[model samples]
Target: MSRFLLSASRLLALLLCAVLLSACVQDLTGPDDPDDPPPPPVRMRTVYDLKVSPRYIDVVGSCDKVFGSPTAGEFQYRVEVNGEGRTNGFESQNYNSRLGVVTGRVAGQQITFAPRTYTWSSMSSPGRIEAVVFGTEWDGAIRDGDMSNRRGARTVPFALGRRPGTVTIGATSECRLVLAYEAEWVQREVPA
Candidate 1:
């Protein structure tokens, strides 16, 4: 009888220990427990379609005849805003192939673009000319699903050379141009 009592006590002790352990675990990991781990951060992405227009502010040096005045034109762009508010996208216009990759940031109602540089070589009358284009100062604001007050500038500096090592002093020219961009929102998307 004493051995039977001992066995029953051991079983009861083990059952009580299991119950206490389960209760502790429930307190720590239950759905309603304050100590429960938070759910994965909600990720939200936004996409905007816009039509951008460019206008010339200034043209200088020999570029006036080469590039002429800025023509009235519009380009389409698809901009994606990530969860962290970083913007990345591409120009959907076929004529905009010359424009390089587009990257920027959007905060609240304000948008800005990162500076970009492009380099290429072309044949001039004398020889091959290397052109470096620098674009900067792009800023804009978003309002009522449209973008306004957008402005930017670009500089093109060229060096003309007859041979790999031969450069002509008078053949080089630098052009500065300013651009104003107006964007009309075509569409907006937010993933479910």
Candidate 2:
């Protein structure tokens, strides 16, 4: 009977020690200190639809033979914009077919598409051929839920050539397409 009491007392003492130790521990994910600054509010995404019309199209270099002159035309596309604090970005599928997702930053009311580079390589019997495309500048603005007389340009410099033996042959050319556009607020989308 005495041994049983001693065992029970030992178990009780162990549990008390555990409880006291747990109380001394601090929660790592607790709320921030009262003196610390509050977190910034989350920014919502916005979408806009625009009708872009080509005002001018210019092709330079010997590669003009490959890409003929394009006539002025208008096309409709959508743009999705996401903003974080001071930095913001927008994505558009109609920007470039070769690029899956185009990202751009927002400054005031203007949005600019970031430059990008694309490369392609192919193996042939005699040698290998490589092609590189460089993305230029594109930007516009929105005011009062509408964009009017927004001007932007898309410049692509393409280089294609073949490396045969120790010599390389290729053609380099650039296409500059300038556009003016008007956009309307289609709708706002918040992530689920």
Q: Find the candidate with the highest TM-score and give its number.
A: 2
Model 1, residue 24: C-alpha shift (Å): 47
Deviating ranges (above 4 Å) for candidate 1: 1-45, 61-175, 184-191
Model 1 C-alpha lDDT versus the unseen true structure: 0.30
Instruction: Tell me each candidate's TM-score.
Output: 0.17, 0.22
Model 1, 56-142: lDDT tens digits are: 122222121225543222222222211222223323333123342322322111223443222221212122222211222122211
lDDT digits (tens) for residues 1-192 of candidate 2:
999999999999999999999999889898678998878777655433221221112222111222455322121122221121121222345443333343332211222344322222121111222121122322222111111112332221122222111111112222222222221222334532
Residue 27 in candidate 1 has what lDDT? 50
Prediction 1 TM-score vs. true: 0.17
Model 1: colliding residue pairs: none
